[model samples]
Target: MIQQPFFTPAILLVLFAIPLALGWVPRNRFYGIRTRRALADDAAWYRINRSGAWCLIVSGLFYLAVAWVVPMSGPQDVNFRLWLLHLFAFVLPLLLGLVRIRHLSRQD
Candidate 1:
């Protein structure tokens, strides 16, 4: 059986979210949502960042669910399954978060 480190994504996402979720991060080019609208306004920065952080939390929970319910297959199928898992775990929430941010930042 192949050993799978299925918890990595959730851990990473949650770790990334802590600062943003808590409003510990300031508006800057290096971190958080640095979109023109988010960067330009202090309020938008915190709101958008918090929303994005929630997205990360949601994504991490989804990862935990996937890890629990997903069945591992033989070695031959491991690579493909891992790839698909990564795509679903990361891409869906990211796209949703970006769409949310786009709408939010445009509002004000």
Candidate 2:
């Protein structure tokens, strides 16, 4: 088993999202999705953030799983395939969250 430092950010994202996902974190400038669509109104803020939170959590878990399953001695050992998987784990959620936000924004 190899320890992947890149995966640490994914885990951190999951941790960071817990509060926002649960609504413990309010809409503010420092955290959560501060997009124009997400911050347009209270409802949009909660809805978008909630969806974003789920995306983050799911992606984070996927990243952790991949990181665990993939064999690598260190950062330098990461190959193109592993890099793509890691990128997908991080970017997929972001794209999905943006879509969700757009969808929610349209509702308003």
TM-score per model over all chains:
0.75, 0.76
- Report the lDDT of model 2 for residue 82: 70
**lDDT of the structure predicted as candidate 1:** 0.74
Q: Total backbone clashes of model 1?
A: 0
Candidate 1 lDDT over 1-108, as tens digits, reads 123344665677788888998999999999887788889989989998898888777877776666566745534455785758755765687677778767877886
lDDT of every model, 2 decimals:
0.74, 0.74
> For this target, which candidate reaches the highest TM-score against the unseen true structure?
2
lDDT of 2 by residue, 1-108 (tens): 336755668778889988888888777889997888666677778887887788778878776777677645676765878777767766786677668766766775
Model 2 weakest 10-residue run by lDDT: 1-10
Model 2 CA deviation exceeding 4 Å by range: 76-78
Residue 23's lDDT within candidate 2 is: 81
Assess candidate 2 and give its TM-score to the true structure: 0.76
Candidate 1 residue runs with Cα over 4 Å from true position = 1-6, 71-86
